[model samples]
Target: MWSFSTYKDKRYWILLITAIIILVLFAVFTPDYILEKTNFVPFSMLIFIVLFWSTYHLWKYFGDKKKRNNTDDSCDL
Candidate 1:
């Protein structure tokens, strides 16, 4: 199981680095697939959208949990 603390600290940076690596790899390895390919999905766009959606959910999940914990702590105090 993953811990919230680990995610809160590293999710954005990790996702960003992974996105950059994948994009660089795709650009170098698959230039033909990416150039003016309106009929098909662009590699960078696909990776970017996936990263954006994943990060949004991760942030929402952690933020909601943190808020709940804070509320609980305040009530206990």
Candidate 2:
């Protein structure tokens, strides 16, 4: 059975995608004043946190996947 946690799950993907889109849109579409008026510093911080979380989960996900593959390979030996 597979269990979902704060990391390496749908939540992680959603946050990662959402943050990327937001950053892209912010840089391309939104104007500088909009961010300044809306408090871009805090918003950027939040996005960075999400990015960090996504990075952590991505590493963990790949690491666990590698471990599982190795174990499976060993079982075939």
Q: Pick the candidate with the highest lDDT.
A: 2
Tens-place lDDT digits, model 2, residues 1-77? 44666545665676678777877876788777777776776877787887777776777789789989999999884
Q: Lowest-scoring 10 consecutive residues by lDDT in candidate 1?
A: 1-10
Q: Looking at candidate 1, what is the lDDT of residue 42? A: 63
For model 1, the superposed segments whose C-alpha errors exceed 4 Å read: 1-41
lDDT of each: 0.72, 0.75
Residue 59 lDDT, candidate 1, scale 0-100 = 86
- Tens-digit lDDT track for model 1 on 40-68? 55665876788776786678798889999
Candidate that would win on TM-score:
2
